[model samples]
Each structure stands twice: as structure tokens, then as C-alpha cells.
Target: METITNRTLNLHEAWFWHEEEDRLRCRLCAHNCLIAPDRSGICRVRKNIDGKLYSLNYGRLIAAHLDPIEKKPFNHFLPGTQSFSIATPGCNLACDWCQNWQISQADEVGSLTRIPEVDPKKVVQAALEFNAASIAYTYTEPVVFYEFARDTALLAREAGLKNIFVTNGLITPEANADLVTWLDAANVDIKAFDQDVYRKYMHGSLEPVLETCKALKAAGIWLEITTLLVPGVNDDPLQLQNLAQFIANDLGTDTPWHISRYYPQYKFDSPPTSLKGIEKAEHLARMAGLRYVYPGNTASSTQTVCPSCGKLLVDRDGYRTVLNELDDGRCPRCNTEIAGNWA
Candidate 1:
């Protein structure tokens, strides 16, 4: 095993793992990777160098921006607020259609060795400086950078900033045990329901993602779901039906589901999902007793309507909120309480 000659490499000792005889078993995520010496996990961010697992990308920010909470595509969670978004290199899931694959698949973009390191304190300071209501660990999977996310989240929470996880939701229960302590809300990208399809396309199982969603809900975190309906992959009628039912029955009917439009990216060449197909999926989800469903990346209006009186409560234009007709997070006209964490 090649030893890590560079001691300056951001080798923050990772949490949630133990050593075996030959390799270190990383319990950070569902993969539970047994990483050999000088090797990394499926994410390539957690490396087992000289017999210990270290988070290589800790506090290394690849992207940071002040974005609208709507851009996180979280229609239900603080709709009109700005979120301080940050992301490190690496992701556990290798979805072929990831738009941020250049950073998510950090190895593909370039060596992160040239990238400068950052500190969680600076992230919180910048979020406060920008007057962002929430700090989002996004772009790449936050679970891969769990240490950094948690560190920043703790500081952000203390500074009166909400913490949001825009994740694939494949984190292990051991890792998720800490989410509730700091995480205020999450938007889990439920790629697909078919286990075989998930394995072949994303190199992940479906059950773990589903379990993470349940755990987040049980922990009382505001949760939303997104599924980019890829034609010939996840847009099957039966699969969409099961997905809708799962959201309604398990995650609660008020859980906002984003039926997104798929565009070709990375290695996959599947044609973009049609607008009609997206509308159909939205219809199925609403029919399954889901109170809020929105079609994304299209011309569809992301306006929120009260489930009781059908009065429009919020109107959004792309990533900006044009109007919000909610009185203390309730419908102004109908007085129906909207399920969200506006406070």
C-alpha cells in the first residue's frame, strides 16, 4: 500500500468507521465500503491512507453561492428566502445524468489537489455576511463531506441560520443519526424506485434512499422530494405510481414532490423527458393524494395552491419569488395552514 507522502492533504479523520484486519470499513454511507490502504471509497473522497479513513475533501469548497431557496427546488421549505449554498468535491452516487458532474465527479473535472482548502467558520461568516436565511450543503452529495457539512451546520445553527441538505439521501443510519441535530430541512433526490435500474444506472440500491427519507421525516425535518423523469429509465407508469404512493403514504401527502424534466448529461444519452410525460407524472402523484406536486425545468408555473380552497399561495419565477400570499405560513384567503418551515 502506497503511503500518503503528503501530510498536508486535507486528511480530516472521518467519523462512523472502524478498522478490519486488512482494510477500514467506512460506515459513513449505505455502501459500507471496505477501503484498502491508499484507496478511497466509491465516492473517492474518503480515503483509507496508512490504515485510517480520512475525509479528503473536508472544508474544501468547490462551489459557494447565494441562491434562492426555490433554486434548491424546495417549493415548500421557506419559499421566498435566500440560501447560502456550498459544495465540496465528490459524490457517492455516479448518476449518469448529473448536471453538476464536473464537480460531483471531481476526478473527471481535475485533481482537487490544486484546489485550496476552506474552513467551516468562513462559510458561516459568509452566509451571515450575505444575509442568507439558510446554508445549503448541495451540488455534490453532502454525505460524502459529512464532517464539513456537520461542522458548518452547527455553527450556522448557532448563528441563527437554517441548514439544508440537498442530497441523494443514501446516507447510512449511523450518519443520519446526526442530521436532526443540525439539519433544518432536506430535499432528497429520489432518482428512481426500480432497484435494478438504480443499481445499473446509479450504482446504488433503492431501499437505502427510501429509508433515509423515512428517517428524515421521523426526525421532524422539513422534507421535499425530487425525481427527474428520464424517458425509458424512470418514467414508467407503474414505477411512477409506486413512487407517488410511497411519498403520500410514507412521507406524508404534504411532502412536496418535484416531477422534474430530464435532460441529457454525462454518459447517458436518453432523450429528455417530454413536457407531456412530466405533466402525466404530476397528475398521477396528485391523484395518489399528494397535496403538492410541481413540474420542474419547464414552462410550468411553480405556484403553490392551497389544498383546501385552491387559492394560489405562492408564485415563483424560475429561482425568484414574485408573490407570496401566505399569512404566517397559512393561506391568506382560506386560512389553510401550509406544511413548511417558514419560521
Candidate 2:
């Protein structure tokens, strides 16, 4: 494959957008940015050039890696399996504290300073060569790279592989309605529960994120949630309770919740989430009737246990599984079915 460092023009016509009188409205994400002539959406990857919205980042792989599914932090999805993860530059949400800001946040919208434009088939072949069970559209918001992920996922599924997303969950309902078919599992990062925090920090809204989670669940795609617990930000008891309750009531109690410990990074200089703080957030989530909860970014045991019989199903040391005592996606002891893509 050949690598092109910079792309001046894009020909791939984008989906999920309609042309207005002069500008185009991109409905891929909740931003719904109206693009003028020669301008890009909020994502900075989809540009309106000469009256059509085109995906500037499609198949432009800024990063690709073979990673354990657990590293995606998808505890319940496909344990002990590896995923072929890929990402392009640009994300719809402008998260200030994004860990992968170098790739996720584009410097410009019109011109792309991207890597090799790998074909969708090439990504599938790479996944197969690596013996990956799934292709994870991760490390950045997959919504902005929808066309690439979608085409690649189709080929991946044909190759007997699964598709997943490690997303910010800012996808619009229309986009997710179509994505639910392509994706088999997803690990959504619910940045914070407070709407105010979302606007001020992430430059987005919270309700769409919640909606995307629900839509994914209702579509039978395996859903898991991660909340990066930043101390003194989204660590409040009441807020955590409501979020946990929403998961239990709307999504389900079986939805695995990962309360991640946040370290000071990027633009945010807040103190790291204390060990005690993550534990408390876990406590509140469990108290709200959520069956599976785990602490993240810490050396904690991310074990999966039977909510019915208390039998340990999966025992893990970091991303490696030491023991998985389940039988065909069900608890061996209680015979209760776990909600995940075990196959």
C-alpha cells in the first residue's frame, strides 16, 4: 500500500446528509452542522465541496493496531479475543480531555494531512491475518469515519468477523439506526452525566449520547458503558445515581458499567481520580441496581460474576483472561445467560 501524507480533494460522497438551499446539513452526529460551500462539518472530516458533502477521512488510516478486546475495555463483548482497531483523523465531538487528540482532533477541515488510504477490503484482510475476532472502529469517534467503517464492516462480517465501536456515543439516531446492523458490539464512553459538563467540556450534549446507548441496546447490539470518573467533576453521588439508574431502567441492569479512573491529561489539569473515589462510584452504581460494575485505569480485578448465583464467570489480569468459567455464554453455576457477544 502507498501512503499519501496530504490529500487536497475528496471524491467519496458522504451519506446521511441533505442539501439545503446553499449549505448541507450533516445528520451523522448530533451536531447537525450546516456546511457552506467548501466548508466542513464540526467533525472536520466531512467537507462540502462544490455542493456535495464528501467524507475527507474515509479509508485514511491515521492509526491501526492489533489490540486485545479488553483493551477496548469491552469486558463482556468478546473476552480473550483480539480486535483489529483502526481510526482516521477527526471527531464530531470536541472533547478537551481527549486522550487521542493528536489523531482525533484535526488541525484543518478542508485539507487532510492523513496517512495511507487503505481500502476497506485491506482492513478486513488485516484483521483476518491477525486472527482478530472483531474490527474495532476505535481510538476516536467512529461516527466521523462512518463511511470507512461501514464499508469495512460489511466486508469484515462477510469474512466471519465481528464489528464493534469504541465511541463517544454522540451519533445521531438516524446514523445509529443504520449502524446497529453493522456493529455487533460497542463500548461507549459516557464522558459525564451532567449536561452542563458536556457543553462546557466536551462541546456537545448529553441527551444524544444517552439516546445512542438505548438505541444500540434496543437493536440487539451488545452494549457496554464506560464513564471516566474525573474527581470533583462527574463524581457526585446524586449524578452517578441517576446515570446508573438510567442504565438499569433504560438500557438494563445487565449493561456492564466501567467506572474509569481519570488521570490528569491534555487540557484538563484536575487531580487524578482517587482509588477511594472510583470505589465509591462503583458502589453507587451497584446500589442503583446495576449488576455489573468495574473500576478502570487501576489495577483492579475486572471479573465477571453471575448476578444470580454469584459465580465467577471471567477472571482477568489487566487485558489478559486468566480463567473464563462460562459455558456457551451462560453461567455454569446458575445457568443464567449473559448479555454479550460470546460467540
Candidate 3:
């Protein structure tokens, strides 16, 4: 009998294990989903069909928009340029407070049916047409739709466009290797520092995420980290301090960390995170030796300051940027070289 392959199907590369169960265990993320025959993995995108696993949402883009690279929460990379952002449904971890739960938690067939058919080549073309300098795989976990994202990255690179991954960074080493080969920048969310919090709130492991961050750093990808401060959960000072210290030590002090204020969404019905808490997290991150840290989703100015002389370099509000005083990523006041691609 001839085997049938779906044109839209993109089988993943990293999820496999020859365990004693005689079943193909998905090693994509920390879940290690023991997929039964004709069943989908925890991510909902990767499925086991006819004894083979395939990503059902591949090349099916649910959302596409031209956004500011800064909106990807990446402050140090192409500061104010536009980025073509896209996402397919499904996520490895099921967070109760997921912001994009409508899509992330839905069935694969439902999401694929609703989202439009987006060709990989067209995604690259959209970037040029929209005058976007980069393309970001965001809104949902990019690792779940690994094949589409990887293929799109290749086309985007060929078109002289930078590829950014806005992810949870809870992927296997094999997937990371494939992605790092084409990924230019990343904004991985370090949800919480506590292992208990991971198990309870996100239903995930913290170690895999930490390992992924280390791998991204070692791959020399322009890395930034974000932490959503939820009230009465993962908001302890000790946890925040540990998270900041880990980022400073493992990811480097130069990596910009965005401490975002979280709004009550998905399953969580608590109040939104307070401005005070966001400010506090920022202070702790700076105290932990992070050179660049900022608060997001609020009224905060983006002024490039010289760490040495405290001189203002570049000023930004939203996406509008004023190149007031900077030459080759250096502070004009003190002539101190900054760490980023200014050219």
C-alpha cells in the first residue's frame, strides 16, 4: 500500500524516543507526550497519525500583522523597525493564565480550519511589502509549528529578512538546533523561577526552559527575556531575585529583560498585576546586575542611556524613534561603545 502524506502536514524533527513502551514518545518539550495512535500531542499541533507524527498547523497562519520589533519585547534588536509577526495554533504547556488561550488551547482541526492558508514564500514577501525589517513567530508557541517556522525562516533569510522567535523556550535540543540555524533573535519567556509554580500554574517544567535559554545564548542569538508578574503567584522577591541572577549569569547581563505587567486572562480571574510590582521586579533585575531592563504594556519611555556617564543616547516612544545622539552603537556623550548592532 502506498503511504499518503498531507500537503499541509509538516512532521517535526526533534520529538522521538525508543522507549520500552514501543511507542513514539514526543520529546519536543518537557511534556514528553506518550502519543497514542491517531492522537495529538499535548501541544495539539503535533499529532500521531497512522503511526507517524505530523504538525497539523504547518503553513496555516492564524494571525499576521506588521508590528514594531519592540513589541516583540525585544528592546536591543532593531529598536524601532517594523516586524512581520505570524503564528499558528497550539502550545506545549497549558498555562491557566494564558493570554492567547482562545487559540493556544483549541483543537488542532478547529484552528487549522479557521486560519488561512499561508505559504512560506508569501510570508517572506509580506515582510518586503510591509517594509518590515524582520519576521517574528509569535502570539503562540513557534516550536509547536516547527516545520512551518523553519521553512519560513529559510525563505525569510533568503529574502534578507531577520527571523525572530518569541517563545517559551521549552523545546528539545534537536528542535533548538534546527531553529538556531536560522533564528536571529529571540524573546524567551521565563514564566516563573519556582518549580512548584511551573507544575501548578503552567503544567510544565522549569529546567527545560532554563536549558533552552542557555542553548540560545550559546548559539549566539540576540537574546532577550521576559517575565510576566502575576499577583500572589511567582511574585515573591526571592523568586524574582533568583530569576534575575540566572539571567545575568547564564544569558548575560547585556540581554535585555522585559518585566511585563500581566492582566487577568484565560482561567485566572484575579486582578491584573500592579504597576508597583512591575517596578519592583525591574529594580530587582537591575540589582541583580542586569545592564538593560524595562517595563512593558505601560507608559515607559525608551531612552538609551550610557551606563558609564548616564547620558541619553536614543529616545523612543512607541515605535517613533529620535536618533538624538548615537554613532555606531556608542554613547555620544561619553563615547562608550554600546552592545548591539547599531549599523
Candidate 4:
């Protein structure tokens, strides 16, 4: 993909804005940062300039790759297809355990020297040329680069390509309303079920993230939930049970829950999640009436079986997929309908 040189042309006016004296209140995410002139939001990308909120990271591509849709861990959406993954620097949330903190925490000073800028038009063209089924706004939070993702998504949609987000689920309802028009699927990281953990470790609130999940599902977006299991942090049995129950009751049992193993990163010094702990969390999720619970970030089976008949439908290992008993997304043996976009 070709990189752009002109920074002025890349500056995009943000979506949600409100004037507060000389400052502009950014309502794009739950933070609702009230930024002063020449100041940026908590995300360090959306800046207030001349009473207008502008996304500084717009069309700036810090990372781009062709990844398996399964790596996004959307076990139910476009199973084995390749997705054109792209991300810009900056994240709204400041998670202590951020694995991609190198890019997610990069600010104006670091970004200018480190990252390359790409045009939205070029992003769409690259996706089409790569023959990717979807374009994923990932690695860093997509909420910070909403304008760029939205513009690219519009063109990608026009070219018959799908859009996906691997996000932190901190997006506001107003932003999500506009996003759902082009977004096809998403894998949102729940982080933790405890409110205290969110406030102290993530520098955000839990309610907004939960609300985002509910809103996305209600908006007809194919939603999947991922929870990175960090040992002695969010691996409590009660917390795992509650998280699973919430997903089963609110998001439906058909919702795929990926319990991922968390490796120590950034400011977090906790030990890596054990395979035993992952298995335990997966077991709890299944016991809580979740139909498609998966253990990720480790060697494990990524198969989709019939909830009713227990027939293996899709057998997967890494990016390799084999359809065993699924006949048009239905169990061939029991004729039970499986919940997914199998076509």
C-alpha cells in the first residue's frame, strides 16, 4: 500500500462534537473528552483546533496485514476467510495490560516519527486487490480512528467487501449508530466483569462497555465477545461465571465467548494465564448455558458443534477449516440449525 505525505488533507472532522466555550467536547466515546484549543483528547488523537474537533490519526496506518478472520476470533462470522487488517495509533482506554501498547499508547510526538499515513481510498483499494472478504479496524482501538474507518468502510461496501472491528467496546451510541450501517461483524474484548478493575486498571468504566455490547447486538451487528484471562487478576471463578451468565442471558447463548490466555505486557507484571485456568473459564462459560465458548491464544480445538445434537459442524486448526457435518449451516445428522453466517 502507498503512503500519503500531505498531513493537512488527512485531517478529518470528528463525528460527535459540542462547543464548550473555547473547547470542544468529543462525544465519540464514553470518555466525552472536553478538549481545549490545540489540546487532544484522552485518546491523544482527537484534537481541538479553532473550536472544531478533528481526528489527528485519520487515514494514518500504523499496522496493516492480511489475517485470518478466525484470528479476529469471530468463530461464527466468515469462518475461514482472510481479512485485511489495519490500525492507527492511539486508544481511548489506558489498559495496564495492553498487549499492543507500543502503537495504542503512541501520541503525537511518537506517532509523527514512527507511523506512516495511508489514505482511506488506498485502504479500500488494497483490500480489494488482496481479495480479502473483510476490512478489519484492529490492533488499536477503532473508536479513535472512527472517521477514517467509516470513510474506508463506505468505499469497501461499495466494492462488495465487509467491514469488521476488533475493538475495546468503548464507542458511544451515536458513533455506533453510524458504524452499524457498514460494519458486518466485531469481536469486542470485555476485559473484566468487575467495575473496580475497569476503573483502576483500564482507566474507564464497565457500564459503557457493556452498553456498547448491548447496543451493537441490538443494531444487528454480528457480535463476538473475548475475555483475556490473566492469572490472579480476572480469573476468579465467580467473575467468570457472572461474565458467562451475562452473555448467555443478554447477548444470547449463540454468542461466541473466547476466553483468551493473557501474557504479561506493558505495565502489567502478572503471570501468564495457565491452560488449566483457560479450561476452567471455558467450562464455566459452557455451564452458564453458552453454546459456543472457545479457549484462545493456545493450542486448542476451534470447532463449532451443534448445540442441540452435539454434532461437529466446522473443524478448525489455526486458519485451516474443514466442514464435517454442516449442510448449509444446519446439522446434517439432526437437522438442527446452527447460528452463524455460514454462506
Question: Which one wins on lDDT?
Answer: 1
Weakest 10 consecutive residues of candidate 3 by summed lDDT: 1-10
Q: Cα RMSD to native, each candidate? A: 1.7, 2.8, 3.1, 3.0
lDDT of 2 at 305: 88
Q: lDDT tens string, model 4, 1-343?
A: 2222335435578889999888899999999998988788999888877677887887778899999888887888887788999998899999998999999998665574355568788998999899999999999999899988998999999998999999999988888888888899889999999999889989998888898899889989999999999887789999989999989998999999999999889999878888999989989998999999888898776888888888788888866676546788889989988887876
Model 2 poorest 10 in a row by lDDT = 1-10
Model 1: runs farther than 4 Å from truth?
1-6, 108-110
Q: State TM-scores per candidate.
A: 0.97, 0.95, 0.93, 0.95
RMSD of 3: 3.1
Span of ten consecutive residues with least summed lDDT in model 1 = 1-10
lDDT of each: 0.89, 0.87, 0.82, 0.87
For residue 111, model 3's alpha carbon misses the true position, in angstroms, by 2.0
Q: What lDDT tens digits, residue by residue, belong to model 3 across residues 52-116?
A: 66767877787899998878887778877899999988888888899899877877775575566
Off by over 4 Å in 4: 1-10, 113-116
Q: Which candidate is the best by TM-score?
A: 1
Look at candidate 3 and tell me the lDDT of residue 89. Answer: 82
